[model samples]
Structures are given as structure tokens and as C-alpha cells.
Target: MKTFLFRSLFGTFFGAFVAVVTTISIIYFGSIEQLDSEMFLRNSLGSIFCGWFFSVSPLYFEIDSLKLPTQTALHFITVTICYFVLSLGIGWIPFSFPTILLILGLFLIMYSIIWLCFYLYFKNEAKKLNAEI
Candidate 1:
């Protein structure tokens, strides 16, 4: 439990860092002129909180040895639900079914790509280890 909490703390810090970078990049590059500084700050904090929540929440899942497909699916579902609910709760996204579905679909695609990349990287590393053995 101590280890898990430590991991969660590390993950949350990492996630917040990523979120801050992302927010800065978007504000710098995307250059949304309509949002005031206060609004931007609020959005940035919301994103950081979301990232931290997401990072820490998944420590409870026991899916390390699960099949790749099952693990990916579970992660995708869990993240999507958490993100969607958070977005709605924070008014980051409007509470509309169609919009929610659209965001979910996009998130599914993004998560699938992420899972595939990690899967391939780990599989290759395992194969290399086996070759050495």
C-alpha cells in the first residue's frame, strides 16, 4: 500500500507536469484569442487536476498480467469514463449525449494508439531479453 501510494504520487506529479506543458503549448500555439487570462488559468488548473486524478486512480486496477486486449480495453473504458465524467462535472464539456459520444470515440482512438505503442515496445523488449537468455 505504501508503494502504491508512492507510485500514485509520482504519477500524479508527472501527469500534472504533462498537463501544464500541454496547456502552455496549446495556449501558445493555438492562440485562442477569446479566452481571458483568468479563463486560461482556470482551464489549465482543471486539466492538471484531471491528469492527476487519472494518474492516481488507475493504481487500484490489478490488470498487469491480463491479456493485452483485455488490459487495453479495460484501460480505455476506465479512462474514458473517468475523463468524461470529470469533464462534465467541471463543465469542460457540455452535458450533451452527442458531444459525449464524440469525445468518447476520439478518446478511444487515442487510447488505442497509446496502448499499441506500449504493447509493441514492451513486446520487443521481451523478445530481446529472451534472445539474450
Candidate 2:
């Protein structure tokens, strides 16, 4: 449906933007130092994509109104676990703490942004649907 597609796309875009901004902020805050621009960009982008994928995966399923909270909690737990695991795995690579934090921070930011976008989109869609009736 249009609503589903809209939410998914919005989520993805919002996630990526947030991840980029967070990465920039981390760099600005001196939390991360980069010697190689290409590697930093690649890791940041990868984190963003991973976050978006996990965050949006749960919403693909349909749920009743009453079950929304439970579904959301499950989604959060799953995403957090996955992100942490992925971050730790990435840390094993030849990167410093700052680099690792920058990557993980971007991932968290993406997750937050996607959730916010989904919330706003769903709220607006619900309102429109109600108005149509």
C-alpha cells in the first residue's frame, strides 16, 4: 500500500540523514579523528544502512492497534542487540575507539531518526484516514 511504501522510504531517508549528521557531530566534537576520508565515509554509510535495515524490518508486519506498543518494544530490542553486535564486530577491525564510537553513534542516530519518521508518518496517515471517513 501507499502508506507502507511512504513510511519505508521516509524511514530510510531520515535514517541516512541522521546518521550523516551524527557522524559529522562526532567529528566536530573531537570524539572521532579520521586520517582517511574514504574509510570514514564507508563505515559511516555502512552503519547507516545497517541501522535503517534493522529499524524498518519489524514494521513490515501488520499489527493491531492494541499490539503496537509490544511490537515496538520488540523492534527496539532486536535492533539494539543487532547494532551492538555489529558494532563490536566492527571494532575488531583496525580502527580506534573514536572511530568505533563515531560509527556506532551514527547507527544510533539513524535508528532514532527512522523511528521518529515512522511515528510522524503513521500519525499523519492515521489523521488523514480518519478525516476521509
Candidate 3:
């Protein structure tokens, strides 16, 4: 219970941090001309939820019956939907067929890179632990 609460709070804070960073990046790149308070608030909240969901997504691996590939695919699909919808709502990506496919392609590439990094790191750590044992 305590760990769950910690993860929840940590996820929320992490989400907020990601949203702020994203806002800064957008401003730095001048992607948008202007952002009124209402839109900013909505986008910030949406981004926070996106980050929170992404952070907690690994919990899906806790399901004993699901293999690693199944967990990975489920997590990927769920987060992709969450991110795609949030991006559309926040105007980060336009609503068009080509643009949609582009965004998804980019997301898949990034997700795969991140997943591989984590997998390799954990695999190394596991090997080290086994060697020590």
C-alpha cells in the first residue's frame, strides 16, 4: 500500500516535470505563437496524465501470467493510445492521415529505443547479480 501510494505520487510529480519540460521545449523552439491560460492549463493537465500513465505502465509486468512480450505490447498499445489522444487534444500533432502516421512512426521508434535500453541495462544487472551469487 505504501509503495503504491509512493508510485502514484511520484508518477504525478514526474508527469508535472515532463509537462513543464515539454512546455519549455515548445517555447524554446517557437512551435506555437501563443498560449492562453485556458489552453495551457488543459494541455498541462493532459500532459501530466500522459506522463503519469506512462510511468506506471510497467506495473503491467506484475501480472504473473503475461510474458515479457505480451506485457511490452500491451503497455505499448495502451500508452500509444493515451499519448496519441493527448497529443491530438493538445495540438502537439495535427489531425491528418500522413501526420498521424508520422507521429506513430516516430513514437514507435522512440519507444523501441527506450525499451531496448532498459532491457539491456536490466539484463546486465541480472547477469552481474547471478555472477555474484
Candidate 4:
């Protein structure tokens, strides 16, 4: 839908911007002798596409009144699949068992950390609101 496209487009540009900044930082701080401009451009665009795809995927989680756990589970499953597929397609991740397992493990750790942070943030906000009432 429209919202999906909007989110995807936003992510595409943001991801590309981040990718460029990261590359620039690396190049500024260290030598990237083997990396040519063409390769860099190609990789940047690919990353943008990956980001767009990832963003659009969240549309599946937009159902109203769903339990938090259900929403989280859906998001995790959708994003994992989307990330794996797009990463492999873009040559960011190789198609291999070891690589898949490694990626999944890292994703799991990061996902848990992010969710915990969100939970804590919302809990604090709720406490503040209750105090004001």
C-alpha cells in the first residue's frame, strides 16, 4: 500500500545515505586501495534496495489490536526471511549453512537487545504518565 511504499522509500534513501557515510568514514580513516568507484556505487545502490525491501516488509505487522508478542514474532519472522533473501540476492551474504547460522545468531542477539530497549523505554514513559495522573 501507500504506507508501505512510503516507508520503503524512506528506508531506501536513509540506508543509502548511511552506507555512503560509512564508506566515506572508512576511506577517510583507512586505505581502500582495492575498492574502485564503480564497485562502491554498485554496493551503495544495492544496499538501498535492501533497505527498501526491509522497510516495506513491516507492512505485514500493521494489523490492529494484535498482542505485542504476536506482532514481535511476525516482525521477526518476516524480517529474518526478507533479510536473508535480499542479502543473498545482493551478494551481501553468501548462500551457505555456516553463514546463514551466523547471520541468524547475530540477528537474534541484536533483535533481543532492541526489543528490550524499547520495552524499558516504554515502561519508563508509562511510569512518568502514571505519576502525572
Worst lDDT run of 10 residues, candidate 1, spans 54-63
Q: Cα deviation of 119 in candidate 4 (Å)? A: 1.5
Model 1 ranges off by over 4 Å = 18-45, 57-65
Note the residue pairs that clash in candidate 4: none
| Residue 67 miss distance in model 3 (angstroms) | 1.1
Per-residue lDDT tens digits for candidate 2, residues 1-133, read: 6665666677667767876787788789866666467766666666666756654657634666637668767777777676666656655333577876776788678878987898899999999999999
Better of 1 and 4 by lDDT: 4
State model 2's lDDT: 0.69
**How many residue pairs clash (N, CA or C atoms closer than 3 angstroms) in each of the candidate models, in the order given?**
0, 0, 0, 0
Off by over 4 Å in 2: 1-56, 92-110
User: In candidate 1, what are the lDDT values of residues 24-120, reduced to their tens digit?
Assistant: 7877999955656776666666676666666765543455677756765676677777778777877888889898888878877887787678678
Instruction: Write one digit per residue (lDDT tens) for candidate 3, span 60-123.
Output: 8778899999999999989998888888978889999999999899988999999999999989
Report every candidate's CA lDDT: 0.72, 0.69, 0.85, 0.81
Residue 133 displacement (Å), model 1 = 0.7
Winning model by lDDT:
3
Score residue 62 of candidate 3 by CA lDDT. 73
Write down the TM-score for model 3.
0.84
True-structure lDDT of candidate 4: 0.81
Alpha-carbon deviation at 46 in model 2, angstroms: 7.3
